[model samples]
Target chain A: MLRHAIALLSGGLFGSGLFISGMTDTAKVQGWLDVFGDWDPTLAFVMGGAMIPMALAWWMRSKRVTALTGEPLPPAPSKEIDTKLIVGSVLFGIGWGLAGLCPGPSIAALSYGGPGLYVFVAAMVTGMAIAPFVRARLDRAVPAE
Target chain B: MPIDWIWGLIGGLLIGTGGAVYLLGNGKIMGASGIIGGLVDGSGLNTKWERILFLLGVAVMPVVLYPLYRDVDTHITDNYWVLIAAGLLVGIGTRIANGCTSGHGVCGMSRLSVRGIVATCCYILAGGLGVILFRHILGVI
Candidate 1:
């Protein structure tokens, strides 16, 4: 019960922050990505500000195995920097540059009520649904994760 | 800096605090893509309710706050083709990478994970390149 409650609160906070910070603003996100065009550095400040508290959280995490609530912490992240990581990141970046809306903002902004929003989200979800099959094929070809 | 920067910072702090709460309470990374992606892929049925509730919270909170932030507009392109293409790429890429801005950029990097750092660098550079190519050269986006 506590865990579920925490998730709700955290998720709500995350969504609220995205709106308050203007991250859901596609124009601002695109402007930040537009380095050659008139660049907006606001995202940098946002990213930096977000990292500060997260960094502290990580420090707290390092000192404990389980969460303060006694649940096991998430498994440690993998260290591999393989082809999949590079390829995926690049693809994601391209899409992000093009659209300026990521998974969080995409979902969070749904209330804005636009046909294009649904179209983009539907397409994104479709891509996710097909990814496993694509990965399977790629793995068969590469044979080495 | 514009007033937007201040709001960005304030909002960022709230986001970080949200992440912190999740980590300390649920003991999981608050990754938007991974949470929803796991559900769609059927790999996260064990935590189906958790994911749903989290997503619900994420989806509903903005609506609750909408009246207060009525000026918050996305300004996304109306081009259906572009939206489709970009959406597809984002979905596939984040899943394949196993993270997105939240997972890799915020949580993972804070933990000093090498994979997270590398992925962040790759995506940022690629995003910049993409902007140049699509917006400047091709004038598509």
Candidate 2:
């Protein structure tokens, strides 16, 4: 019960933040991504500000014993840069630039009750649904992590 | 081109603080990717009602807040098809990469996961390249 509550509250706060920041509005995001043409560097500042606490948390966790769950934190998984990572990154970038909405903003945008959110969410779910199949096929060839 | 940095700062603070609270109090990483993925996979079926309620909250908060800044124009340059294609691609990328920007860049990086660091870096590079390709190279702007 507690865990579930925490998850809900955390997500709610996150969503609220996105809403307050106008990130749910796709145009704002596109402005940020349009570096060469009317670039909005505001998103960078947003990201940077967000990174501050996250950085502190990482530093503190490194010195701690157990996580908030009282269980031993999993050792950070380390992996080499591979083709899959590169290809995946490229795909993500292209989509973000084209649509001006990523998972975070799209999920937050659901509040507007618009067709665009519905379409984006549907496609996101479809992509997730297909992931297992793609991973399985890749596994047969090169055992992805 | 001009952004409201004040709002961005506020958003970042909320995400960071909220994420930390969840971690310290609940021992969980607040990754949107994992939460949404779990929703679809039925991993949270035991608490289905709560999940639905949570999702409802997420979907309604913007409406509640929209009244304050209703005057702002939220138009985009791209058409519906472009946005749709972008959505499809992001979906696949997040799945393939095992996370999204919030998942990896914010939550995972906070945990100092090496994977998170690498993933975030890739995200930035890809985003940069995409902007260059679309706006400059292709003159799609």
Candidate 3:
């Protein structure tokens, strides 16, 4: 029960960061995306600021054994790059350029109450739903490690 | 440019701190991507409440804050098709990469996973390309 509360609070704080960072605002994000026009480099600073906690969290976890849950936190797994990665990256770039939205921001935007966010979230969920099947089919065509 | 750095710092701290607590308390990595993905999988009854609440919190935050911080505008000017495409692409990317920015950039990076390091590099590269392609190559700017 307490664990669940902590998770929710953590997620809330993360979402709040996205909201406060102007990341949830499409225009601000689009401005960042518009590197050639105004070339708003502000998002870089936002990203840099955001990474601070991430770095600290990593450091803490790496040195520690048992977490607050009394369970050992394992190190992350490693994997090689493959075709799915390349193709998915290209598609992600195209989408990001076009919509000026990423997963965190898109999910964060839902709180703002807009039709676009709704559509975007729906599409995002649909894509997530379809990914496993697509990956399976692709994997069969080209066995990867 | 419009954002207040102090607010961002505070928010980041809270997020990081809370994430750490959750990690310590639950033995779970605070990765939003994995949580959301797990929710979709319908794993078990024990996790349902927490999953629903977490998602609800994510969805309700903006609405909760809109009244308090009325200065910022949430309006958008982009075309619908573009936004839809972008969302779909991000979904695919998250799956293919085995994680999203939250997973790789936040949780994975925190654990010092080599894959996290590589994935984050790819995320930044993709983001940079996205900025250049949209603003320069396409002249959307």
For this target, which candidate reaches the highest lDDT against the unseen true structure? Answer: 1
lDDT at A44, model 2: 66
DockQ of each: 0.81, 0.52, 0.49
Which consecutive 10 residues in model 2 chain B have the weakest lDDT in total?
B70-79
Shift of residue B104 alpha carbon in model 2, Å: 1.2
Predict model 2's lDDT versus the native: 0.68
Q: What is the interface RMSD of each candidate, in Å?
A: 1.1, 2.7, 2.7
Query: lDDT score, residue B30, model 2?
Result: 59
lDDT tens per residue, model 1, B1-141: 358889889988988888898898888998888998999899988998888888888888889988877477688899999999999999999998888999899898888899999999988998899889999999998
- The RMSD of every model to the true structure, in order and in angstroms, is 1.4, 3.0, 2.9
DockQ order of candidates, top first:
1, 2, 3
**Tens digit of lDDT per residue, candidate 3, span B40-68?**
54433467666666666666676677777
lDDT per residue, candidate 2, A18-104, as tens digits?
776767766667777766667666676667767777667666777887766574644565566655556565677678777677787
Candidate 1 docking band: high
Instruction: Give the winner by DockQ: 1 or 3.
Output: 1
| iRMSD value for model 3 | 2.7
